[model samples]
Target: MLRWTVSSTDSFLIGYNDLDNEDNWVEADGTQHSYSRWRSSEPNGGVLENAVMMYARDADDWIDVNVESSRQFICKADIGASAIPQPTVNPSCSNGWESNGGSCYYFSSDQKTYSQAQTQCKSMDSDLITIDSEAEWNYTLGYIRYRYYTRDYWVGLTDIGVEGTWVWENGGKEPTGTYHWLAGAPDNSGGSEHCARLDRYNGYQDASCDGAIYYICEDDLYISDAPRSIQTTIQSTTSAVITWTTPLQMDSQNADLIGYKFYYWIRNKQSETTQSVTISSPDTFELVFDSLSPGTTYEFYMTGYNSYGEGVASDPPGNFTTVSAQLRSENYALNIYRIAKGVYLQSHVIFSTEAITLQHCTNICTGVLSCQSVNFHHKATTRAKTCEINEGTRESYSSDVVSDSDYIYAGL
Candidate 1:
């Protein structure tokens, strides 16, 4: 529900629905009002009108007239009641880069191999620039024409993983219907070219991966600059509310922004993986993440997006932990060993520990929310030296024969 307020000295249209009688005036919700704003000569209509319109001459000036009467009205938006609070607008780019299309681009001056160039970009938390549209391609071309007309620059396009299956370094499939390759380009010249390069000379072409070349790096603008004053509230043991301030200008002049993306993960499990939530709305600056692990600290970061692309990610403002959930019977289930000899669960390991007793191993498996089984192994040099805690139920295990008795498998 939203609330509206009248300006101090501005006339406006309100949700009043009643006959001309000031005695019957009420708000849209049928709430009775003790206050009156009628002008000295207002409500002159005798049972012939049923509408109210404020006048700008004075703060309390109002006039009652025919329902069909027309007049200019002032409009106001309530910030406190907005579904997503209005974010303070602020946008920026990192040093030595220019912002465009919701992203930032850096044209390197030095040359390096395709792999090395990619590594350099990664070191900056960016990647080799990938042109997803003709506009972006033209933008890059314009930059090259102005500053590096004849110089070759590396792009993120490649077919290195599989011949003839081109993909962007960002993990997107090759674009179709609008290829910008030069005549007879990407012919896999010399049977060794697997990387792609861009220049004014020949739009784009395949080159040797080991070939040294300058490269461009693309960083999402919103993600890099990020929103400010991020505030988070723990809603429950499994949910939290996150809010941030972004100035209206954070949106492109055309309001190309489409949404904000939230990336979060448990602090200890960050290296393994992260989860994401995308709230699609140019104006939505607030979000709620649910079904999160309880009693564990979580780190959160955000980035804004538009039709063009995603902006730079905001530095993680801080961390928040949900309240612990009430303990349940399943959480206290006994860790009874299930015997499965000569077989080891494959590719299910979530964690591993060294030199722990079988009893301790069982306890470890039970303690983890995802662990349902454990694999204990002993090498010739050290007896029971390793334990592999695995996810997934025992029923889903695919057994692989391991003749070594020192390698034992158990599930709880």
Candidate 2:
């Protein structure tokens, strides 16, 4: 019996096939080849295995194999050696840093605590690496493993601010579905582990912030400037549209403009209640907000972002008020009547003044052309009375009208 030097399963495809006729081989690109090297009785599979492969177990001789079979193949380039571009040092990055995906990365040679690493990065005008997407994570992992091998690297993730709530140093909360932690990791073991590090063998693991480790630094190539020319249009009684122009200085070469972040709330109630929405398209310049209270005023501002980070907000937020439901018809007759007691319409004031009685407030509303409602605030002890003329009626802005014991609402 003869012993084989190579495994029986070890085979590699050669770019030659005879699909048209048996024993008539041709190159993969449809050209004929005259050179022939085949194992004895090899073209046996015929039509079923028209492709040729080199079988290692049979002294690396050519054999017919199924064309659809998965096997490693060889490749040859037609270009001359000098035509291929040679790798050159990237001018955008510093001496020891590497440029990738429009960002610069620096793998530190010295070990330091997480805080020390962050300080070192900041000294160089960069930050400890914050992996934003899976592609970025994979690239960092591959680079470290290939270059440094099996080493722990400090990353910019910590829950020190609020335990179990990991946030980047830049204050962005950890986004879901973007990172995979090592199994059962970030356990905050012994109530002391707060910093995160990349373990080359598995994934991220929580470690003590004081523990020394190698680190990676990242510098963003560019960030989008703030959006410009913010404008708003009332679309309906319960809906409004906000539009803005793209920033003029947004760069598309080094980094990609990802989207815009919109911040809005009822004016004067921003500290109490604010909402934000992220429009995840670079080309979108408008956003529509529905389900708004009729005649309620809203203040909004927008900021653009790229893969690096969010930019500054648009200066001086724009404001708009939704149209009143009853005011949709232009020909409606003005007839003032008592709508509700202990109620007032908020944030649609056309004018306000002191009034001695409820009837005096109604008379003031009748005189103002834009006034559709009136709120009379009366104090029994001080004998003080005030009137608020509103541009929205109680029927049109029911949601904006709220109960207040000292006020009365009258609609036109």
Candidate 3:
């Protein structure tokens, strides 16, 4: 197996063609070295293969290879007198809270339901812990293993809003990278396991939200400022455009502003099926939502995210309603205004019959009292041309209507 050495790049060389010069050798950290362990004819690739690697098969002698090539790499760490320094509790943290990576964590001894645990965290001005990165996850797992080895703890991960789509309490989706779920876990057994818990034996498993379990809470030191100047515009009957400005105090935080997360939900709906979209570019301040239901009002908000996690959502969420459908005309003579090319109404078929032409199909639909829409299909043979009359209109069944090259949908 090839392994990387503490040397790379040929930009420091006095001349590009000087392969035998030891003066050109410099560590990745810019420390000059005169050490010579090169194999015969090594370093001949010069400009192209600038990185040096130790050849394990050839007496561990060094060889030059392309810096971009993937290989096992060795790292060196500096050790001091106090190799592992004792952790000091943060002064700002409350009693019994431990600090790591600029965040304070509290591991509860009392078992509570997921809701109760979140309430307790809210009382302390914190939320259930969200493991944002691999370092945080490792630290949390290690701390739990050492301090609370026999117990399962609840974190702020759940899919209660949208089943099978786990989200952190901070409103970020479960990251695509570095998630730790045991094999065949999160089965959502009995269809009631909407919450996630950290198992002592395994990684993560879905559990009933009502089941009592210990929990962890976190208080971050560097919370990001929320976005401002949120605005929404109704673009059409089924779409809208939302815009917002970047947070005013973004540079005050130590982390970079990576992106923004947009949220929307129907207004006055009991279930409140909220959905979120993550824009991974900090420069993007606007987004268009096209899959909205007509005549429905929706609330919108946005939050900025970074390496730490999601910040607070913008205040005073914008609300907008899509344009409502016009009332059907009482006179069927004006039905030509409802005809749409390359569209087909799905289901609710009142009757299917052969028609001589597209005009004949419309006339047949006009004669049927129950027909609100008609789908006319074109065929090579005149006798094979067909018409399907439906009781539903495109405005009434917007989701069911689809585009098709062979059919024309006309509403009466």
Top candidate, metric TM-score:
2
Model 3 regions lying over 4 Å from their true place:
1-85, 175-179, 224-412
- Candidate 1, residues 34-91, lDDT tens digits: the string is 8787888776753334556776557456776555445555455567765646543325
RMSD, one per candidate, in order: 22.3, 15.7, 20.8
Q: By descending TM-score, how would the candidates be arranged?
A: 2, 3, 1
Model 1, backbone clash pairs (residues 3+ apart or across chains), number:
16
Q: Please provide TM-scores, in order, for all candidate models, with all chains considered together.
A: 0.36, 0.44, 0.38
Best candidate, lDDT-wise? 2
Candidate 2 residues lying further than 4 Å off, grouped into runs, are: 1-79, 86-92, 174-179, 224-301, 305-321, 324-412
What value of lDDT does candidate 1 attain over all alpha carbons? 0.68
In order, how many clashes per candidate? 16, 0, 0
Query: Against the hidden true structure, what lDDT does model 3 obtain?
Result: 0.72
